[model samples]
Target: MEITIISAQGLKKLSFFTHNLQPFIQLTTTPPGAHRSHVYTTTVDHEGGVNPTWGDKFDLSNIIDPSEFFYNKCSCIYLYLYTNRVLLGPRLLGWCGIPVADFVDGMASVGTVRWLSYRLRKKDGSKGHGVVNVMVKLDSSVFRKKGGSDVRWLPEVNVGRVAIGIPVRTLPVVNYIIYYKTIK
Candidate 1:
């Protein structure tokens, strides 16, 4: 998948009193706790404009294995904006969740670029401070379904052994123990 961040609108200031500000996107193509090698970031917009144009495109592949498990469970792409301050640390500006599957199907049917506008949201899913506009296209040439499952709902378990010992003289021993080792 090729994701292009065309622009953004209504970026919030880091503080009401300060004038210096910078902004950028910290983008990820998968839900939380997934792999991170697919993350894409843009350079900070140093002009301090409320609306910034990135015009940056990123390729997303191998973020999730194209298997039944991931295909069924995977949902959205996350976009987070931050303020790159000179003296102060980066501040979270806002976030947005893009439903990739919903748009990808339509893009495939039309075989054309898809443009979308996602309302920025806070971590709590309330309306945030901005809106992001993007263009995306799936590179069918790089798409492939590697035959394997990326996840297992239920894991295998190992069960075995027990040992019991009683007190002897002035020494105390293992009262009870279960010992087991997983087999390959």
Candidate 2:
């Protein structure tokens, strides 16, 4: 399988930060009910300046066109990105499979995500992972393509975009259903 690495720095080096990751305010997945927290709502300053308008991360626009990406010079492929923080997970950017128009049944997934939420740590020191709600805010990035299977993985892009919201996995919790829409 061929892979493509989309970068603002250079086609060769993917390490150098070139200011391309933008954050968009929306959710990747929403079960029956999940709170809409203002996780991301900011703009990016490309000049490498300190103190951004909203946060350190820039709001990334969701890319639906597979044409914008070039992989192995030829073969078309779907694109998705994940942040260093994989606690949240990956999201679908674009692919040649199914168009997004047919997607979006209810709470449509908008962008890619890699949540940084503070999930429970493991006693064995491995990594406690699950959809458990805690008193503290999760250091999450957000994920896309929850109920659907359109999700892709693009580790080439270090950090991508995500529409902020709770994962559909945590929908069963009574607290989630009660405070999904009210909080904004």
Candidate 3:
């Protein structure tokens, strides 16, 4: 899996001395059953202040177990927004956890780049002032042909019935129904 840290918006200034925020993002993820988490950091954006853009891409293959990450309900990619301080150390401004399930839909839309934004949260889990934008892509290798054949296997899908209703003055009512079959 690969993720691009595009930017953040509406970030609150956490420092008392300066309103100018030199913010950067740190991403961490721990695979199911793994003892340690993998961490990646982005370069600080000095000029962006309340809105910062990094556009940094990181490969998370090292920490991701496709089967576990995509299936485990507890799997999440944690994002922490921080302001770099010369002497006081990095201070956490806000953070959020993005569940791996958020990327599952993109897997079915193979070769498509999807950008998602999540609201940042305070230390106490309250909604914070910033939103983080990121682009996620599943590696192509994940969809390689099985059994050395040209045919590629797709993930199984289960869908329910959807009904559309149309109201007509003359006919009273008309219904259009579409049913999606479960793909295995």
The worst-scoring run of ten residues by lDDT in candidate 1 lies at 152-161
* TM-score between candidate 3 and the true structure: 0.73
Q: Give the clash total for candidate 1.
A: 0
Candidate 3's C-alpha runs over 4 A off are 30-36, 144-184
Ranking by lDDT: 3, 1, 2
Query: Which pairs of residues clash in candidate 3, taking residues 3 or more apart in a chain or in different chains?
Result: none
Best candidate (score: TM-score)? 3
lDDT of 1 by residue, 1-184 (tens): 6778888988777668768557788888655445655678988777747888888888765564334322542457788878776677887778887763544454433236889998887766788888999987765432445654342221122222245788457766668878999999
Which residue pairs come into collision in candidate 1? none
Every candidate's lDDT: 0.68, 0.24, 0.78
TM-score order, best first, reads: 3, 1, 2
Index of the highest-lDDT prediction: 3
Give the per-residue lDDT digits (tens) of candidate 2, residues 51-111. 1122323222232223232111222112111222134443222112111221221212324
Each candidate structure's count of clashing pairs: 0, 22, 0
Per-residue lDDT value at 183 in model 2? 60
Query: Over all chains combined, what TM-score does candidate 1 have?
Result: 0.68
How big is the positional error of residue 166 in model 2, measured in Å on the Cα after superposition? 32
